[model samples]
Target: MKKVYTAIDDFKKQGLDMEIPLKLLMFTGLRNHSLSLLKVGDINWIEEIIVYNAGIDNSKHKVQFLPIPPGLMAALKRYIEENNLKFNDNLCYGIKGIPLQNKQLNRITDKICWDIVNQRTFNFI
Candidate 1:
C-alpha cells in the first residue's frame, strides 16, 4: 500500500490529471468501471456520501451510497471547483474534458503496481 501510494504521489507531482480519480479509487475502494462513470451529481455534499448507481445486470445492489471521508471530500470539492464542474459533469475526465474510459483508469492501477514491483518509474503518458 505504501509503495502504491508513493507511486501515485509521483504521478501527482508529475502533474498527471488522474490524481484525484486514483485517490478516489484508493479511498472508496470503488471499481474502475464505477469510478469512470461517476458524475458530479453523484456526490451528495450534504450527506457526505457518493450515490453509486450500479447499472450492471448482475449487480447485487442497483444503488449504493458510499460514505466519503472528510479529507477526501475536501479534495474532491476542490477538484470540482478548480475544474468548474457542473452537476452533470463527469467527476474524472481527460484533458479534452471527456469522461475517462475504464481502460484508462485500469492503466493507472497497472502502472502503480508495475512501478512498485519493478522498482522503477512508470509513465502514464
Candidate 2:
C-alpha cells in the first residue's frame, strides 16, 4: 500500500473534490458506513464539531462527538458552498437524490485511494 503522502499528491493531480473525502476519512477515523450517514445538521458550523447521532438500530454505543479539525472544517465548508448544499442536506449523496449506501461509499473511497497511488507511481514509471 502506498503511504498517505503519495496518495494525497496523486489525488491532487487528479484534481477537485477528490481529496476532500479522503481527508475527512483520515482525520475523523470514521468508518465509511458512519460517514455516509452524516447530515449537514450533524456538523456544528459555529463549534467546528461533528456530532454523530447513532440511532438505536445503527449505533453500538450512543451519541458521539468528533472535533472538526481546522483543515477538515475548511474543506467541508468549501464543499458545501461549492455544491450549494442546503443547510439540511445530507452530506453524502448519490444519483437523483438517492443516498449512497455504506458499501458503495467504501468501494468508491477505496478505489479513489487505490487509483491515486497507482496513478502517482505510473507517472514516475
Candidate 3:
C-alpha cells in the first residue's frame, strides 16, 4: 500500500497525466478492461459505491459495487464538477476529454508492476 501511494506521488511529482485513474486502478484492483468501461453514471452517490453498471457486454464484473472511500469520492466529485462531466461521460478521460484507451491503462500499470515485481524505487513511464 505504501508503494502504491508512493507510486501515485511519483506520478504527481512527474507531472504525469491520468493520475486519478492510475490511483483508482491501484486502489480498486480494476483491470484495464474494467477501467475502460467506467462512466460517471456508474457512480451511485446515494449508495456511496462505484457501481459496475457497464452491463455484461461492457464489463467483466457481474454488476457489482465497490465502496467509495471518502477521499476518492471527494476527488471524483471535484473532478466532475471541474470538468462538468455528464452522467454519460467517461469517468476517466484523456487530454481531449475522451475515454482512456487500454494502452494508457497498460502504461500506467506497467509502471506499478515493475516496481512491485522488481522491488525498486521507480518504474517511471
Candidate 4:
C-alpha cells in the first residue's frame, strides 16, 4: 500500500495524466477493467457516487455504485473541466483521447512497481 501511494506521488510529481485514474483505482477499489470502463455519466455529482456497469465488459457483470471521497470528487471535477469531457466521454484516456485499455493501465502500474522494486526506472518493459 505504501508503495502504491509512493507510485501515485511520483506520478503526480511527474505531472502524468494518469494520476487521477490511479487515484480513482486506489480510492474506489475498482478493478482495472472497471476503472478503464468509467465514463463521465458514471459519476453522480448529487450523490457523490460512481455508478459501475458491468455490461460494458464481455462477460456477466453486476451493477453497483461506490461513494467518491470529497477530495477525490473535487479532483474529478477539476479533471472533467480541464478535459472538457462530455457525459459519455471516458474519464481516463490515452494518446489521441482514446479510452485507456486495461493492458495500458496494467503496464503503467507494473512499470511503477518495477521502478519501486529496483529503485530505478525500467524502460525496457
Give the alpha-carbon lDDT of every model: 0.80, 0.66, 0.76, 0.80
lDDT ranking from best candidate downward: 1, 4, 3, 2
How do the residues 6-123 of candidate 1 rate in per-residue lDDT, one tens digit apiece? Answer: 7767766777666678778887888888888899999999999999987666657578788998888998999999989999898987534578888877767777787778888756
List of clashing residue pairs for candidate 2: none
- Model 3 lDDT tens row, 1-125: 77777877776676555656876786677777788878899898988888775455654447767887888888889989988889988898643346888887776677787887898875364
Across 33-110, the per-residue lDDT of candidate 4 in tens digits comes to: 888889999999999999998775555667888998999899899989998999999888752357888888888877
TM-score computed on alpha carbons, candidate 2: 0.70
lDDT of 2 by residue, 45-106 (tens): 88888898778665466787888889779978887888888867778654233555676657
Residue ranges of candidate 3 with Cα displaced over 4 Å = 57-61, 94-97, 115-125
Among all windows of 10 consecutive residues in model 1, the one with the lowest summed lDDT is 92-101
Per-candidate clash tally: 0, 0, 0, 0
| Model 2 collision count | 0
Worst lDDT run of 10 residues, candidate 4, spans: 116-125
Using TM-score as the measure, the top candidate is 1
The parts of candidate 1 lying over 4 Å away from their true place are: 55-59, 94-97
